[model samples]
Target: MIIGICGSPRKQATEYVLEQALATLREKGYETTLWSVHGKWVDYCTHCDYCLTNKECVVQDDLQELYALLTGAQGIIFASPVYNGGVSAQTKAVMDRMRAVVAADKNFFKGKVGMGIVTGGDRNGGQEFALMQIHTFFIINGMIPVGGGFFGANLGATFWSKDTLDGVKLDEEGFRSLKKTTKRFAEYIERYGVKDGGKQS
Candidate 1:
């Protein structure tokens, strides 16, 4: 299964593009799930070091479910709206709270295929930086990161939403990038299967 995580808080461009990305994967014979962080309760990591010993987070919330989905999936597509030249707080929270899941099993994310998508309000709204941030998390967790190779999609998928869903729909280049990224993602997973389940159970 491939899981697409949408870090947007609204039913806007970010979520729309992510849904399309998952649809593309589904059409390619991959079972895909869209996990949106919108309106979900996910606490920020407090650097308490609780999970380091207990092997779990001290606070319980929606993230508990995400942990399972992430580890069990063959691939992960982390999609976020660019915020201050980076991922949104919701997306970062998901990335940060993974410490507990990783603490429980250090290799849970090892060998998994991961990629990123970023939507921005402006043409040069640091979309690439936000995309890179997601890749950094994937690398730190031992997952293999994939991008859209060259040309238009050199940094995975990126959309200039212009702060509106309709605007994103009009982004021809963005759709092309999404197509390239998802095509590569599906092909990579099909050709070189993941090395681990990354599951806790």
Candidate 2:
């Protein structure tokens, strides 16, 4: 199954692109699901080492469900809006909490394929840096990270704030290209892909 972990609120391009990615995955006979962590007050980690052994978080919040999604999916498509050259706080918190997954199983994220999409406010903006933040997590977690024929495909070069904030319009044209990249990535991972330094369960 292919799962999308979206950390954006409202119906932004993340939702649209993620939906399209899932649709394409479905067309390819792959089951898919979407999980959004929008508007939720997910707190940051407290520098605790609880997850390194408990296989879960000490705090009770959205992370409980997120941990299951992370471990159960065959592939993960993660998306977030670039905020000051990085992922949003909510997204970071969720990713940060992944320590629990690591603590539960040393190789918990092994062999899981990951794709990160970041929306930028302007052209050639912090796209790469923003993606790096998420891709770094995948790298350290032993997940295979895929990009647009490179290492991190741009969801688009830029985003129109007016259209984005309104949620009435999305980068459909950009998503069309991104859809191709995402589809090809999904297939590659499914057919002949494995997580870096990890194994498939």
Candidate 3:
């Protein structure tokens, strides 16, 4: 399955952007799942070493369910609204809390395909930097990071949301990036991901 993690705290541009990305994957005959952090109480990871030994997160919260979803997904899309030139705290929390999941099985995400989507209020508002951050995490987690390549989506799907859903919808250039990125994302999954009800090792 292809899973999208929407890190927006509201039902706004970030969610819409991820929705479109997931829709593109669905069109390619891939099952998609979207998880939004809106109004969800996901506590921050304190770098606690409990998981290092226990192999599970000690703090029980909304992120527990996400762990399983993320583990089962063949492809992952991390979409976040730009906050202070970076991903929202919610997104960071989810990323940080994965320490335990990794401790449980070091190769939990090995060979998985991951991508990022960042939405900014203004053009070139640290979107690339935020995308880098997500890609960095994917690399560190042993997942393969894919991008749409040159042209519009040099790093991944980027949108100028102007902090509004309608504003993002009007971003024609952004849609081009989204389309290109999602197309690449789907293609990668088809080539490397599980098939015929078999999982990739």
Candidate 4:
């Protein structure tokens, strides 16, 4: 299944964009699920190393369920809203908490495909930097990172929401970029398949 993770604390523009991307995946006949972190309690890693021997997070939060979803997903889309020129604290917390799974298995994300989507208040509101941070996480975790292409989404799908849902709806180029990225992600999954539960399926 394809998993779209919305890292936005608010359920507005960021959620809308992620839903649109998931809709495109569904249109292409891919099984998809949307995981929203709006109210999820994903705590940051304390580097306690408890997971190193236990193979699970000691914090015992919502991330336990998220880890299962992540492990089972063939493709993943991480979407976040720009906050002070970077990803929101909620998004960063999710990424940081992923260390529990990573500690369990060094290549936990191996062969999985990942894409990024970012929403900004302005046309050039640090979208690229946010994408880079997400892409870096995917790479360090051993997942393949996919970009939108050579055009509007050379990094990833970026939306200028102008800090509002209605403004996001008005960004035609942003919508197009998201659609194109979704298409590419689906195609890649179909052609190459994914590794689930540490095995390629």
Candidate 5:
């Protein structure tokens, strides 16, 4: 199945972006699911070694469920709203926690296709840096990171709150550009998705 992952702290906008990405994937005739990683208080990794023996993390928190979702996804849409010059602490924590999974299964995420999306507060916000942060995680996990066909997939950082995300939009143009990027991402999946490539690396 194709899964969209939202790693943002703002639940509303992240959900909206994730919904659109999932719809794009569904329109391309793929089964889709979305998971938001900001629902609970997820802690950072503590360098604990329990994962080596238990096949699980030492920190008992939300990411345990996220780990399950990761294994089930064939394609992933990873979205984050930029904080400062990169992904938020929430998203980074999830990425750091995932190191345990990489350890448990060295090739756990092999062949997975991943795309990046980010919303910034201003035009010159650190959109590209945030996208690189997400892509770096995907690459370290052995996943292929994808960008848009028409243009790159960096969503102009958003200043619109949940209340203004839809109706009278302030960042609509940027979001529209991001939509094109996400659509291209969906098309890329349709073009080169590997669903039956055997077990993950």
Candidate 6:
């Protein structure tokens, strides 16, 4: 399944863009799931090393459920609103808590396709930087990161939400980028299949 994760605290522009991407994947005949971090209690990683022994997070929260969904997903699209030149706190928290999965298996996300989307309040509001940070996490986890082809989305989909959901709709370039990125991600998943426990199936 293709999983689209929106890390914005509000169910506005960020979630809307992520939904568009997920819709594109679904239109391509891929089963997709949309997950929002809004109202979800995903705590920051405590660095307690408890996962090293138990292969699970010690903090009791929604991350446990997310872990299962992430592990079973073949494609992951991570969307976040740019905050102070980087990913939002919620997004970072989710990324940090991924350590639990890493502790369980170093290559838990290996061979899965990952794509990033970032919404900014301004045209130059650090969208690229946020996208880079998200892509970096995927790379570090051994996941394959894909982007829209040449001309646009050199990293991934980027939207200038201008602090409003409707503003994102006006950014036609952003919509195109999201569509292309999602298309590429779906194509990759179909071509390579999904890797589970180091085996592609």
In model 1, the number of clashes is 0
How many clashes in each structure?
Answer: 0, 2, 0, 0, 4, 0
TM-score of 5: 0.84
lDDT of each: 0.90, 0.69, 0.87, 0.86, 0.69, 0.87
Q: Please report, as a residue range, the 10-residue window in candidate 3 with the lowest summed lDDT.
A: 192-201
Best by TM-score: 1
Quick one: how many clashes does candidate 5 have?
Answer: 4
State, as a TM-score between 0 and 1, how close model 1 is to the true structure. Answer: 0.96
lDDT of 5: 0.69
Which lDDT value does model 2 have at 135?
A: 79
Candidate 6 lDDT for residue 22: 81
Clashing pairs in 3: none
Model 2 per-residue lDDT tens digits across residues 1-201: 677888776567667666767787788887788888875557789878877666678988876777776666668877777777777777788788888778878877887878777776654457668778877988898877766663334432223233364431455545555665676667668665553323345
* Per-model TM values vs. the true structure: 0.96, 0.84, 0.95, 0.95, 0.84, 0.95
Looking at model 6, report the run of 10 residues with the lowest lDDT sum. 192-201
Report the C-alpha displacement of residue 73, candidate 6, in angstroms.
Answer: 0.5
Displacement of residue 56 (Cα, Å) in model 6 is 0.5
Model 4 steric clash pairs:
none
Pairs of residues clashing in candidate 6: none
Compose the digit string of candidate 5's lDDT tens values, residues 1-201: 776767776566656766766786677787887778755768988878788887788887877777877776778777777678788887788888887887788777787778877766556567778878888887887777776544433432233333334521456665666677766666655666556431534
Off by over 4 Å in 1: 199-201
Report residue 119 deviation for candidate 5 (angstroms).
0.9
For model 6, residues 39-87, the per-residue Cα lDDT tens digits are 8888899899999999989998987888878877888889999999999
Model 5: how far residue 23 lies from native, Å: 1.3
* Best lDDT among the predictions, by candidate number: 1
What's model 3's TM-score? 0.95
